[model samples]
Target chain A: MDTIDNLADNQPKLVGHDHVAQINPLLPLRKWLYSWLFDPGIPGNHQKAVDRWISILIVANLFALLFEHVDVIYEANKHWFHWFDIFSVAIFTVEYLVRLYLAPEDREFGGKKFPRLRYISSPFAVIDFLAVAPFFLQAVIAVDLRFLRSLRLLRILKLFRVLIPACRQFVKVNAGRTFRQKVHALVFAGEYGGTLHNIFDMFIALWVVVSVVAVVLESVQTVHYVLNLQFVILDAVAVAVFTVEYCMRIYSCVEEPGFQRAVLGRFKQARTPSVVIDFLAILPFFLEVFLHHLFDLRFLRVFRLARLLKLTRYTSATSTLTRVIVREWPVISAAAFVMLLLVVLTASLGYLFEHEAQPDKFENIPQSIYWAVVTLASVGYGDISPITPAGRAMTIILALLGIGIFAIPAALFSAAFSDELTKEREKLKRDLYEMLADGVISPDEAAIINREARRLHLRQNEVDHMIEKARNDRESVADLSGLPIHRIAAKPEHAIEHYKALLGQIRQLGILTDGLQFEQLARQADRLTSSELALWRQIHGNHQSQP
Target chain B: MTDTPEQSGVPLALAPALTLADMSFLVFLAAILMAVVWLGRIAYLEGVKTEVTKASGEAWVQWFTEASPKRFTPGFEPSSCAGGASPAGTNGKSAGSDAGASVNPVPERLWEGCLESLMKDVEPIAGLRNPFSGKPLMFAAKCDTDDRSLVGAMVLEKLTPTPPGSAVAYTTSSLVGADIIERKLQLRVTVCDKGAYPIRIAEVEF
Candidate 1:
């Protein structure tokens, strides 16, 4: 306790004399470290960044462990691996020690009499200890080298510090009666999944990267010779994991709102683009194993790289891109049609002009189309160029036209991506405003906001700013209630926006708007002018008329 | 690799047998065929590259393991490769006694003041690696109590290492049960090859 106080005293003193600070001199340092490691509720604490670094460190340790087993790699980077291990051990030891010391302040254990003891026995604490124990043990004890290596492998379990809590939260959130509902909660990334679904998403995404890398590495002759068995094993494991995930998705797909009919729902789910990608990811392996004798299906092995597309399921950017493409499909297709027409027209003209001078090169329109495409794409390969003056002039004109025409799609895609991102941000702001309407963010609402913020890649400070702006917007809308009739008449757009906000607020009232509340709202409504009253009734009637 | 329909045993339906009612079915079948063709085209474009060259008449297969001479069979011997030869003695193990006989006794309570990772169980602990240092750290004891039912004393000696040339070798040592007078005990013992890792006991209880 004195050591903790001394450590606290050495730091710049805070002015607060709160009950906690007064009772325990160690509270300041403990709370600061605790907030940094675990909680984000404390202002100025970068819990997210801390979590990210720790997660990165854990992944790095796993990579180091993997490299240690590869003889050439270990031999070459022996000093690096040794120092990296020491650095990792130091970080993990400090983390474990700090967490242990701050256990009394942790939310779950704070109320317990022996909080430190309870924390030590917790699964996360055990994992943390295991992560740091190996290095210290190796330093002090004469232990078998193989035994030490296996213990180092336990560092992988330290990831459970993040995963286990998410799993528990997911289970708690999806405490439904049916297994189908629970499975749905686990797999999908909407209301129920929160953190757990992201973890699962990340796991599948990591495998996708691994399998793609293996496929790429297999192309190298020396690497293939040395790691053929390992590559095969990794591929097999990837396929097995993807196959199980695909099966699970197909099974629980009926829990989705539209996919309620079992057979048709499963089929529909399979037909979806993401699910199709999932199927393709595992299909090549099965085809090679089962149908290779029928044909040279080893060619199908290349399709294993399609597993990379499975990552689109986890990234919001892909979804945004998909939305952009869908929204601008007509325009994009129009551009493509124009480009195709230009290619044909250019090919015909090139043949007409150059056919006489270079019969072999421009023998036919079909062959000339290749030159047309290449020329239009600005890739002027010297293998095919018109030598005749008329042909050269025509070629110059066609190339200029191609440049302009080809850029249409590129420009459109970039603009659409930007527009989509802005629209998503706007939608997030609107959601924040709606959530802030009731003046308090419920736990569920907070979770939704956090998930949306993450999906949009908005920082915590940015989200806080948005929340503040939303609160102001809500207040401004409410402020319209006390405005004079003349002022309301002067700003028609403001009145309409105010009306919509009021409707949203009233809708949120739902069955909670009892007689007293109704009377209060009625009294407030009584003060409105005839025009405002008529507009309100019209909007209200329209809303009521809708199913 | 292409085979004729007759050789492939692919039965063909007569084109003249189709009618207007079959048009929708024909379109669906064509769509399926188109999808398959598209997939095949993609696979062909991305197929694994294979290189081949004409060879002289003779061919053979050679197979061998570390202890066996290479044996050749017809039509499978690979092209000769050079520059991997090493003297036989270059890969031999160093001259040292087997690890089992290298265990040495050390002073009791050698690690008295240090932090340690520990586990206690009635059954023998298997694969008990230290959670802190991530090393195989375990000490097992079967205590003998006096008639008064008090644990008198305990001494945990490291078990003998696995015999050389055994089917499986385990590095973990077992504790032989014993009787002693003290309620608490501490000891350190060297237990690995060339005294590389020493097991130190900070404290132990029956």
Candidate 2:
């Protein structure tokens, strides 16, 4: 107790009483309230209160979506709908304000100086503002359209913020150590790395800005607006910014890391699937902006969506999907290529067969190709067709090919899904083993294992057996007398006496003489006996507790 | 390639045992049903392809736009071509009178004929030459009590033959003495032909 007290006195209290004392009285009260409201780890009752409120808010929004479609409901009880909206808006606004009030000072905009501006600038605060602003803005701005109230649907984004804590737990469980280690190393790669990263990041930001500006200019109603000029300007700016960023990234790597070294190292270090994704993200932008014509530029937008794969770095599920895709790439790629070949062949045949008889339908090779593509993919738009009998037969064949092509991806996913489930089960088994290492499973730990096993669709008996084995192996040195046993009378008196005599003989042989050693041996013997009894009970289906 | 209608030595005649009116009506009905079936087939095929393409990872919009132009059979051209001519003739008798009589006499056509008959009978003094054939014409009137049918009068103008085709102007006026009556009137006018067969009196109306 004295030693424990000494250790406690020596330990640094980074966020203990001193930190609480440092906080202004008013600020501390606000922080306490915020934690009370939002903190998930609050003692049982308050946590339940928070969960109930969140559920109520979710249910309210869902009800609003449903009710918004029912004009009669609104007409019959107009006040009810308005009141629901007002209540939700009020609760969200208060929560947003409390968060702003309790935000750490350093994180607030302008630190301590411009508190109001700081509060307004936060993202959640902006969400709160947007959620309620449209209603009042409608009143002040004299916009009277009832349908405009639907913009309140933007409040759905706030649900994403609510999901963040759950996503954090999911991410911690799924991300491999290699990813964490690489991120740590990259962070420490110093000024050059930082500058290069910043340049690429800035380029992306600038591209987004230019794209938005172009969209706005294109949408303008004025006769003087020139869409071609906006497109040209957007193209030029994107090219210029991307070129600079790429050049800087290339140049910086040339010094310490060496260009090839940096590139190879980064490639080698990247989690296998991300390397391909990273290449795809940058390649399209580089090709379109620096090397291609405007007509070809639009195709790059497809690759821009691929840039979303970079979110794998932040999203565990996406990363796990990427890993699964990589592991099964050979099969997937083979299937994909086969499907592509089939599409091309079918389209070519369709064009040939349908061209002469149905000139309008298969006017040219490309037109027939389109029909073949749709047919093979099973879209069958029915706009064009083969008027000839042979052409119809070919279409039938193409439709069958489409089914096969569609099934390939599904099969690949099923295989990968099962593999993932198996891996999760094994991980649960390991966790159960660790928890049961002290020779007994706590009720809480057992409950968690049961829940996880059920979630993974694993047999509970298998998990229990693994845990018992681990426990017995870990407690091989423990005293046996205090150990819980239910089957003391299962062994006859003569057998018990014989076993006791054997144990004495073993001790006399100097193999297990010390008390700790004797205890370990006894525990091992107890584990062996219990395991045998467990197996016997399992087989017989009639064994019960004897103690 | 050698299977030409001209080489077959069978004259291509405008005359048939069945009147041109019956043939035209049948053709019109057939055309409408064909169009509906064509559209329906295309729509069904397109719907199936759309669902299949979506399942195969193709974007719905891209697949739809790309497939639309290729989804239909080409429109068939008419087997025979004829030059356009004005539907009116000299002596206030219109070519539409003959063509209308050849087709089904729907209510609209009968009403138009009635209006034309009234105009001609009221203004019999006003006459003009047939614009294509350049033939002078006068009104013709015929009513026989032996047949209880009321027939409108028709005027016949001269026929002028051209290098490629010939044009003729004709009119029929039949008197309808009864308050309520259904009547059939027929007029026949023939013209010389250059490349194709000679024009025959296929069918006509008063």
lDDT agreement with native, every candidate: 0.61, 0.47
Clashes (backbone N, CA, C under 3 Å), per candidate, total 24, 36
- Which regions of candidate 2 fall more than 4 Å away from where they truly are? A1-307, A322-353, A359-369, A397-405, A438-547, B1-206
In candidate 2, the second chain superimposes onto the true chain B with a TM-score of: 0.18
Candidate DockQ values, in order, are 0.01, 0.01
Lowest lDDT block of 10, candidate 2 chain A: A12-21
Question: Candidate 1, which CAPRI tier?
Answer: incorrect
Docking class of 2: incorrect
**What are the root-mean-square deviations of the candidates from the true structure over C-alphas?**
27.0, 27.9
Report the C-alpha lDDT of model 1 over B1-206, residue by residue, as the tens digit. Answer: 22323334556322243345245444654664454445444333222111000000000001112101221222221211101222223222222235642352211111111112112321122233333224444232432221111111112443333689876653433333221211222222221101111222221221
Candidate 2 per-residue lDDT over residues A1-547, each given as its tens digit? 1111122343222112122222233646655564455544433224335544754585567557555655644667778877887788778777666666655432344257777677778675686677767766777787755555566776766655545444443334223323322223223233212333332343365464555455445444331122233344344444444333333333233233333355574444443464455455556544543443223354564554554554453335665577789989999999889887887787678778877877777777767678877787788788987778988897787788688887888888888977986787678767855764444454455446655654554554575465556654544433333333322233365346555655566445434334345335545677546675444334334433332
| Best TM-score among the predictions, by candidate number | 1
Error of 1 at A283 (Å): 0.4
